[model samples]
Target: MRVVVLGGAGFLGSHLCGTLLAAGDEVVCIDNLSTGRRTNTTPFLGRPGFEFVHADIAAGPLCVRGAVDAVANLASPASPPDYHRMPLETLAAGSRGTEHALQLAAQHGARFLLASTSEVYGDPDVHPQPEDYWGNVNSVGPRSVYDEAKRYAEAVTMAYRRQFGDDVGIVRIFNTYGPGMRPEDGRVVTSFITQALNGDPLTIYGDGSQTRSFCYVDDLVRGLVAMLTSTETGPLNLGNPVEWTVLELARIVLEVTGSTSPLEFHPLPQDDPTRRRPDIGRARRLLGWQPEISAHEGLRRTVEWFRARPAEVAAAAPSVAGPQVEPRPGARIPSPRRSAPVLS
Candidate 1:
């Protein structure tokens, strides 16, 4: 099979590309590098049956040669810090990027997959959010750039499926972290891991009571592949069901890294979800899939990854010389994990 993956150099997208390639599929990876790092594709640069294209899916039509059996639209500024910095670009990705990917799939009679997010269920009123839940998003909020973009993407995906009978699927991904995550991406896992390694305070927003469910990258990628090959047209939820509070997760990070970094408190960002967990019944029922990696095991592996790259983690760490100043909206830390061996 020939697969086209947008945002292919990103943390999750890079893993997807590697998985598809290992499964004996020809892969064409596309990324704009606005948020994605080129080094993420370094391992596959000279490998057979893999190609990387530097282009923005939202800018205009994508130019490609030959046939495509599947198109996975994973493009966009996915992290909170990223989307917050590139608001217009994020909006464009969900709108124009999604449209172009759908068109490409439709033209080639290929299966289409939209990599939506759990953010669509923003600050949910429903516990363990199911796909059927209408989200409680504030369209004008600071996080709306990503939340609403995904919501729009899902809407357009369903529209194409209903109106044109497009072979389309939408997977709402939750918090997934592993080797490829950038240390300074401002995600809870990455922040905790990097800070603990650097012997810095683990910054906990609010009283750290907010909750989230994290899936290992490998497990999440397997679920993605299952959705790509399945016949279900769904807004399926794909995430580990194990739930943990922000404080609990921080403590776990401390344990995993064996760091004595003290915990520091800060105000929670506006519109940040106080609770999040996925009811992945649809994915389990339709695709016969559930996460196999336990949180403790996953965190152990992740800490090992960061520990092996001490310089990268230190370089990515925010300056803490004197007064505490918030990082600029979109500032990014270089991720060297791209050069690391592919996770099995």
Candidate 2:
């Protein structure tokens, strides 16, 4: 099988590509090199079955050398820092880019898997969000660019599947973290880990009571593959059921990193959610999938990855356009002016 992984060079996308290749499938990864670094995909450059294309999926279908068997559309900016920084591009990627992937999948008669997010749930009135919930989202909020874009992407995907009889699947990913995660990435785990490692004050926004469930990247990838192969075509939720408050997560990070840094509390940014966790009943019943990595184990792996990366790469990894602050862990980059609450 030849698989096209949009955003294949990104932190999660790169790992997904590696997994597919290891499973004896030919992989063609397409990335815009905006958020994804070429060095990230260097590992697969010379492989007989791997190919990389430097193009944004929103721009159009890929010009690969061969036919594709499946399309994993993981092309959008997932992190708060990335989406807030590249809002327009993020919106385009989720909406137009997703549609583009569906078209390509339809044209090639391939299975399509859309990597949706739990942000679709917004600041929910319900605890442990289930797939049946329609979600309470602020469409005009600053984070609307990414949130609404994904909602629209899911809408378009279902339209393609129902209207055109396309074979498509939607996986609503949750707060996932693991080895390939960029150290400076704005996700809480990375932020806390980096700060603790650097002996800097860990910033805790909004009194640190907001809760989120963290899923390890490997487990998330496995679930994605399972969904791809399963017969259920749905907007299925994929995340760990374990839940922890922001302050609790901070304490865990301090313990994991053995840091002496104090915790600093700050005002929560606009559209920040109060709580989020996944209900995996559907995933369990349909795909026999549940997250296997605990938050402790996953954070340990992520911290190790951050500790191993070259200083130059770590400094340059987040975004060149970001603030000029030192690239240390826990270094507080400015939040987006009109930020929406991110899934993580």
Residue pairs with colliding backbones in model 2 are 143-340, 194-329, 195-329, 195-330
Q: Which digits, one per residue and each the tens of the lDDT, describe model 2 over residues 175-240? A: 988877677777788777777777777888879989999999999999988988776798899999
Clashes of 2: 4
Clashes of each: 0, 4
| Model 1 segments more than 4 A misplaced | 319-344
Clashes of 1: 0
**After best superposition, candidate 1 residue 134: deviation in angstroms?**
0.6
C-alpha TM-score for every candidate: 0.92, 0.90
lDDT digits (tens) for residues 205-300 of candidate 1: 889999999999999999999999998888899999999999999999999899999999887778889999999999999999999999999999
